[model samples]
Target: MTIISTEPQLMPFFSDAFLEKTARKCGFMERLRNIGPQSLVLSLIAALSKGNCTSIADLHRQFNGMCLSEKHTVAYKPFHNQLRKSAFADFMKTRVTFAMVQLIENVLPPLPKKFEQFDDILLQDGSSFNVHPDLAGFFPVASAH
Candidate 1:
């Protein structure tokens, strides 16, 4: 059962202090303008929800409906294009995953894979596609033998 709320509540609970601290440490505040570090977080979440999403029109209709603060609202085709097309998603995911790897690498007890230092290398991967039914045509294929 889904209940509706009139109040614009926060979906992912994050603290302003936490964001400010991380922003200063990671130097994200240098590049981001107008919006806060948490804005990047919200956009990242929007982008993920926008899987198979192409074009900013889709992004606006999809993410803008969410309960974001007016300042957090994303607009302009350029913003969506920049978020989905640029290396932003990959970069964010890489940073987060790498941090987790570094943390859990030594902690959280050990597992069978932990013993395999030979394959200790960690890999991060990403992909995207369009919602268009004819999207497969966009994929490249090498000539068959």
Candidate 2:
């Protein structure tokens, strides 16, 4: 069985450090130390592939699905449930805050120059987006119970 979903294999553009640093700063380190940030990102990527980015409920479903998966880190010992529990809900709230900051950091590129010529136009600025809050799980379950 292909336990490790294909999303991680497919999306090679994502940066590991970004997720790690963001996750750590946000306090996901304790909850996902052994699983690591990359796995969390990978699982999140896999689950979010099934839903729309703009839907708030979709985020809930994706994380729940991934956490329930045997391959996901939470499966071995499902401590928190952002969907059906309060503790997890608070935890998720913090995660969401950090994730949003990380996301914005990712999409908006850093300012390149201190100044630009007025007469001589310099074309600058590009757009990038990975619009899924659900891309925040470890692996996935080998089988759903």
Candidate 3:
């Protein structure tokens, strides 16, 4: 069982530049320049990494521990409003992908000490359903070959 740390220490791989690069790749910061100077995306992710932010208030508390500058201070309501924006959702999806890739790269499951042999058996409920040829495109199956 792997015990992941709940500490809010910023990892080197998930640095500001790394996240900024991802944000840029995902077009989270594509257009106009009149927005706030703070990197809310980084703040949000860092806060979430700490395992403390379950609600708006908790997020606000996490901001301080995330090492955000005083100038980057953002209230819960405004942050929540930004989160509700569609653009933020896209950014989050990209972040999720990055995290998944990192996990896959870093985590290796332990090998069994001794291989166990077991009989192969297949069991299924006695039921079948018909599929229309026209619907094959929507429900494609693997080729038997």
**Best candidate according to lDDT:** 3
Candidate 3 at residue 39, lDDT? Answer: 53
lDDT of 1 by residue, 27-122 (tens): 444455544556556555676675876755665555555535675566666455555543455545555664556545554666567567665655
Indicate the TM-score of model 3: 0.48
Q: Cα deviation in Å at residue 74, candidate 2?
A: 5.3
Tens digits of per-residue lDDT for model 3, 14-123:
56667666666666666433222135555665777878677877766565445446665556676566657776678778776756666665456644555334345366
**For model 2, which pairs clash?**
40-137, 44-135, 44-136, 69-141, 70-141, 71-140, 71-141, 72-140
lDDT tens readout by residue for model 2, 7-71: 34334334577656655665555554445556555555666676656553444345545564555
TM accuracy, model 1: 0.39
Give the 10-residue window scoring lowest on summed lDDT in candidate 3. 1-10
State each candidate's clash count: 0, 8, 0
Better of 1 and 2 by TM-score: 1
Candidate 3 lDDT score relative to the true structure: 0.57
Q: Could you tell me which 10 consecutive residues in candidate 2 have the lowest summed lDDT?
A: 136-145
Instruction: State residue 69's C-alpha deviation in candidate 3, in Å.
Output: 4.6
